[model samples]
Target chain A: MEKIKIEICVGTTCFVMGASSIQALEFEIPEDLIGKIEVTESRCMEFCKDHKDGHHKGPFVKINGEVMADATYDKVLDKVRAIIKKKEEN
Target chain B: MKEELFIEIGSAYTNKAGQDICGDTIHFKKIEDEMRTITVLSDGLGSGVKANILANMTSHMALKFVESNMDLLRSSEVMMDALPICQIRKISYSTFTIVDSNINGKTKIIEMDNPPFVFIRNQKEQVIKNRTLTSPKWSERSLHISQITTLLDDRIIFFSDGITQAGIGTKKYPLGWRREGCKKFTLSLIKKHPNISAHDLANEIIEEAKRKEPNNISGDDMSCAVVYFRKPRKLLLLSGPPYDMNKDKEYAEMVSLYQGKTAICGGTTANIIERELCLDCEIDKTSFDKKIPCASIMEGVDLVTEGILTLTEVYRLLKHNIELKNDNAATRLTKLLINSDNIDFVIGTQINNAHQDPNLPVELEIRRNIIKKIVRILKENYLKEITIKYI
Candidate 1:
């Protein structure tokens, strides 16, 4: 199985808004996907309110160099599955 | 007149009675002669009014359940199941603790899963136990109170984590009063004033904590239960078929058969038996189970609290009163009752169930099997003489 890197921003702005869910996602994912996913807790993703959503509107996470904003557990899982599928196609 | 002992009761509130943020504490003396007393302290998770409601609900439900009908173990199970849970939010939870002590100086303590309890005994402090992530977040910790027999007089202390978090004495860590710090403080108090009443000591500790740090922390809704014991009384327990209204009379008759003044406990039927038999009875009010009738009659007895906790309390009561000696005795008696050989007749009943679909009995079997399982566990763990009979 090929490995995919996952970065979760624990930045003060994101954390204050709703980044708490990411830590939980780290543990909830199944055992088969454990080593396949690398979770890094970074201090700041610099998500500005000036973007698509309003102020304090983010919990940004990156999957294989693709940035996903307002990331939720389900959204992250879907992205991870897609990433794995893309790898298999190659 | 036989000397009837009364439990001293008292309460202290944060504001004058009928105020908004009512941080109040109520405690009663241990049920006479039986060194055991149950103390419940609930710190509603939030602050101000919402906190008050949560705290009150937690303490009221826990006390009413434990003190009235259910034993410590059963009450814990029922309350944990009953508390409301919000699936979306994780932090909205109630943290509570129960400290049950016996006069012979034995104590059993339980803390819910959410907020863990700090056990401070003999100048040593430690977290009671941790709850897994699977447990409800509202329930910080539910600890089985460890037994403390050697202490000359045991004090089952409980307080909301707010007291520990206040950073009064020390604040290097976010968690305050700390299990170790509280333990050392309590032990020092015991050493300094061996005769100081528990009530006064609790107040002193609060005052000292407040004086140490005056940081807008209004002593996070404090409450504690200070229990002491002198002489031990034997425990007497009995239970008939589950939800068997007719068996109430049989239980009353059995209590009457015993020599001591009986405290008949049950619902309306148990009350009826008390009237007919002319025996004392008291209702176990702590239970939310509507199936068991309400009412017990009592005469000149010091104190009467909950009736049968579960099949287990029945075992404890029988052991202390009848002296069955060990597992062999309990097993033999259980075999007799299960086989219906010893008792001339055995009765069973059914309860209304909304969830039953196809082939399940509305009411599960409540006889010697459940009783025997509890007895076997107790006998294997601790040696006690208790026996039960079914008819």
Candidate 2:
């Protein structure tokens, strides 16, 4: 199976708004999902700028182009696991 | 068109042993509009507070007079007449050396009782002719004036009598480190570190002079200044992401084509460069500071740090003129900023929405305001030329 791409926004706005905590997603990935996913950091994905007045906010994380705004460690983990599970089933 | 040489002026001084203040003063002014620089080193008659006052006054007046383009001889005569005579010594005395140089042009040096200035080219001392001028009213005092067309890699060093008269009665040399001794030492130093900066050279000369005294305690108020003519060191500091996402490529191209040291101060900005330039960005985990974020490494960039927070720390450090003892991102950035002669700041105008919250600490100031403060400090305090552009 092709690896899932996870890009975390570490921009100034995202980092201060809890992107730093979300950065831990790199290490907290479950052992079964480690090799199946690739994690990277993006300086700024500009999601905060795009969704200024929307329900979405930052720290933002993207899983295969799906942005998770106002992201947290557990939220990212759950999303990553769900994606991996779906990938396996498909 | 001829390229203007960057005149790096550096001075260092040590007070007389057990004295709270140095009796020697070095003053420098850069006339940006005229593309000229004037540096003056003054040594008063004696050590302690009285000497400090005399030296300060002489240097201040000398700089002002030279800036006004007054006649050097007449200026000296006026200075001599205005100085107050010491009650105990029955003489008002201060020695001064004034260096007026036009960038990419001729340099004029006027020396009084202070030691003759050392002129070096290609690490070798060059002989220059001097014209002596005297005022009949003060017949005993004479001034030596010299003019030379400065070239790249040339250096002019001047100092107070303290440097020459160190260790007057020492067992090693009763004569002390005279003019020849100082010259020889400077030449040897230049030979070792051919591209030594003016700041380090001045500091090393002062340290060596102090070592000549007993127990490394200077016998008099020692001072040394070096004027080095050389190419300017440039640095490009990129911070924040551009407001228009389409301009990210242009921002990265600026970093790719910059002809000097480069630093990235924002995570988002670094990401854009990394993506656009196809460069790898890796976090250096060990460099993390409690307050500032850890720095990253990117190919061809001198420094990569998280924005806003790191910049704020840099501002504090530069403002306080603090000595850096930590290997954190902020200190590293500050070191690079200070070492460069010319700095170009590319500030991304994109606002970070998180910073807009009022509850956030006031120290997390808007990025533009912080950068403006840093630019002012760099210019006024460190004498660095700064150019800023908002993308």
Interface RMSD of each: 25.5, 3.0
**Inter-residue clash pairs, candidate 2:** A43-B268
Q: What is the lDDT of residue B258 in candidate 2?
A: 97
Error of 1 at B147 (Å): 2.7
Best of the candidates, lDDT: 2
lDDT of 2: 0.87
Q: TM-score of chain B, candidate 1?
A: 0.45
TM-score of chain A of each: 0.78, 0.84
| Candidate 2 local lDDT, B1-391, one digit each (tens) | 7764698888999999899999999989888999889999999988899999999999999999999999888998899888999999998899999999999679999999999999999888998999999998899999999999999989999999899988889998699998888999999999999988898899999999988888898889999999999889999999988989999999999999999999999877888899999999998766754456678899899999988988989999999988899999999999999888889999999887667766543447788999999999988777788899999
| lDDT by residue (tens digit), candidate 2, A11-52 | 666767777776665667677777888877776667665565
Clashes (candidate 1): 37
- TM-score, candidate number 1: 0.38
lDDT of 1 by residue, B1-391 (tens): 5322211111223332234574433433244335346666666554566666666667777877766646655665555556555345544456666666554445565566323444444434444443332234325444444545535433445555544544654555345656556556767886887544444556565654444344544556654444433111223334332366565566556555553333322122234444556765433223212222122225643223222222333455344544333323223333232212111222223222211213322333344455565555433322223355454
Best candidate according to DockQ: 2
